[model samples]
Target: MSESAASYKQLKEEFVSGLSGGPVGEIVAVTAVLPIAALVWCLLQKRHAFFKPYTALGNVVDYLLNVGAALLAITLYANSAVLLMVLLLVPALFVLGVPPSTGARRKKPKLPPAAKSYNSNDSKDDTGSSSSSRDFDVLSTKPFLTFFRGSMMVLTCLSILAVDFRIFPRRFAKVETWGTSLMDVGVGAFVYSAGLVAARPVLKERAAHAGGRRAMAATLPRRLAQACRHSLPLLVLGVVRLLSVKGLDYAEHVTEYGVHWNFFFTLALLPPFVAIFQSALKIIPSYAALALILGVTYQVVLESTDLKAYILTAPRVDLFSRNREGICSFVGYLAIFLAGQDTGMYVLPRKINPRSGSSNATQRTTLLMTMAIWCSIWSALYFLTTDYKYGAGLSVSRRLANLPYILAVAALGSLQLFTYCLIETLCFPEFYSAADPKAEKEAYNVATSRVLRAYNRNGLAIFLLANVLTGLVNMTVPTLDASPLASMAILVAYSAVLTGVAVTLDAFDMNIKLS
Candidate 1:
């Protein structure tokens, strides 16, 4: 690298270095806005039928709720985080802390009157026969999970480049080595999401084959090939990104993942690993337990030995040393992935009948179990992150993807899921009462939250587009020196483009799945 380029890289590195981050409560507040805003937006759309009167207004609302609010995850959030937290506290205390409200306002297909997803039964020893299994269903359309995942992706898209500009809050950027930031959602939540979507299929496979070694042997080659096919796209993207950054002398941060390592490569490596051990439940039984074992064992390695030191300080003479951070952090991400997969299984049915009280009972049983586990996770988080010894206060490292980081991801991800479920249950009653779940799901998707569906459909494609746009803007415009007004204008326009494309693609049923 040239001297001036080297100096510029140094300046960029220093700017993002050593940040301890703001209160975790504030980060949670930023997270709170996503589900709250999405639920509110869905409600408003259901009630107003805004698109019927004015399509443009509906589009704007989608932008604000999906992409615009996601931008807040990285910027403008630290300012009024307390207010958001206060708003979140009221509902959280009522929803998770106390008995779930039994009163659900019933509405028709237009609004699907209520969710009542978390209500406890009058039967003290109720068998798990309840509609609460599909907790965030919003019933057929899945607005909650779709919107939730889209927001995370958009926020990541915005923050990856937003950190380069002066207008973006430095505190929200990825932390130097440890602590938390809004951007710290990073690959943990993301890979967790990937796992969430993959969970049902894995379960189906396990059930069909009965975890037989012979069955796995028959499917293993095809699974590995399919995984490789998916991985190829990501590998190509990683190589292209690396070559472009080096060839163009782009402004880059080497320490972020270390020399020659980028997020794409980190992603590229995961699929094959997943394919190899996708049947792990046969041996470990519970994905949650499996994830905990790997994460705690990795944490032990980091704390008891010199691996962490080697990752942080080793010379980049060989490929392994050059990308130590990404290599080591992969274990953490995989654990988070399995944990997410466990959650995916939560909302699905173990039997064929959607309305069979017996099946519903099993699903509800799973939901309650999930909640129990969720509480234990939070308790573990509190103890592990406490400041006494290797607590999160001192040991949490986004770079390392340490034990504390996995716990935080699991806690926060579950919190978001539960919040959405609570909203769907309270607001949409037709879902559980509907005779045909397949038809109702389609109706809800079309009538209420098509934008979110579109986003969910073309997630990877949109992320790639955002990456391209960010690079173009950085190359053509002086991000670090732009006026605040100009920067805001640019960011809004960027978000608008992303949301617009997603909407348009959904309108046409165009879906792209690139790693």
Candidate 2:
């Protein structure tokens, strides 16, 4: 047979193969075990040391990471190989802090001579204030670290993996070829990434060890302004999305099925609103309460209305569902995203330190217990919901924020993460060194450098390039092809090619944007 015929036959064979649910489950199980094992081993090795103080830090990071990860999940909904890879890759940024080198170049940790003299003079009465301010400054540097390490690592792994397989859900039987979920993920990623940057100053203020709260407070408005401004690129993307609905004939293309045209429009409206909310949070101290109220209200709407049906299946409209039905109606979800962002801005701290404790072992044990309970609850819910068929019929009363669902999802995630930690610990007890975390980094630097170099040099450019690449890929292929194996293969190929191109361009410091 000719080469073309052979290629077609191979594609046919690939399409015929099904994803073995067992393997998928095992992968999930292993990923969960890695982190859990890591946590345990760390505790065991450091059992002689004190650990309580670090617990808060871990908790804070975990919370932020989860929110960030959830933002990543929006990509999964789109079921795009490109989108999923991006989603999985970007969160690594939040997990790992900025590279050590970036921090070194930014500034010298020095006090102004006048301030030093004033500090010396005031030390007798207000040393505490000065110390507090210093701590805040230290914390502000974390975002850069996280952005560099986590984002690079995650993206590298995801890009490589995309060449191996596509990861997605088995449900959504007749869902579009690609996931409309990318819209959410794209919006969420920008929001979450930018939010982390904005959070740095606020958290720094809280962590400050030397500057008095007054000094920090005085600088906050300016800091907030800078953060908002830095986030403008993402916000602009959102605006483009919103306006696309009006000017772009998004529907003319067959590839547009999974494209939720208005998701970004909704996202475009979040930052400014969040900025306003954050300002209020300074005065009210009720951001959490407000978030709770709004979340609950949104849930109530989901539960009581035919909103979901209308949003998921209906034809297009100007403002509402783009024209489908579901509680995820653009207008409604936008409201939720705005509310969530505000809550996160005002209530979520930038860095969380663990509580000081006398024993590391004890804290580890506590975390493990928490994981066990969370897992139990999640397992229970998964089984219970196995029988609940999701219908297009709108049950206006089933809020997506229903207590059970929220609790279950969180628990499942925690359990999964803990399990992964545990497995990693079992596999390699040492922090990254045991498995040479930098192995990939070095390899990425060498072979993959051409495409990734620019991204490595500057994150913003890489992000734009990545999105454009993803969009182009999405336009080129069927986004929602449901056969798991076939989808996975296609995505893997797509990811591989993109990564190769990205790496090649990065190595050369060629800044290119696919968009």
Q: Give the best candidate by TM-score.
A: 1
lDDT of 2: 0.36
List runs of model 2 lying over 4 Å from the truth: 1-137, 140-199, 209-231, 239-260, 279-291, 304-463, 474-493, 497-515
Say which candidate scores most in lDDT: 1
* Candidate 2 C-alpha lDDT tens digits along 444-509: 222211222233344454444444555554445544443556655555454444444544564475
Model 1 agreement with the true structure over 1-515: per-residue lDDT tens digits: 77866776667667777777666777787778777766656455444344433367767766776667667656666577556545544644444344322322122234333333445662222565444534333223354567667767776777777887777777777887877777786557788788888676665565556535344443667878888888899999999989988887777666678788888887887778877766675798777788888888998899899998998888999988988888889898888887887777655433323445554445544565565567477547756665677565545677998888887788878777777666664554344433334445644563445566676788888878988898889778867778877877888888878877888888777778786
TM-scores, all candidates, are: 0.82, 0.47
- In order, the Cα lDDT scores of the candidates are 0.69, 0.36
Off by over 4 Å in 1: 1-10, 51-54, 84-141, 206-219, 350-369, 375-379, 389-394, 446-448
- Lowest-scoring 10 consecutive residues by lDDT in candidate 1? 100-109
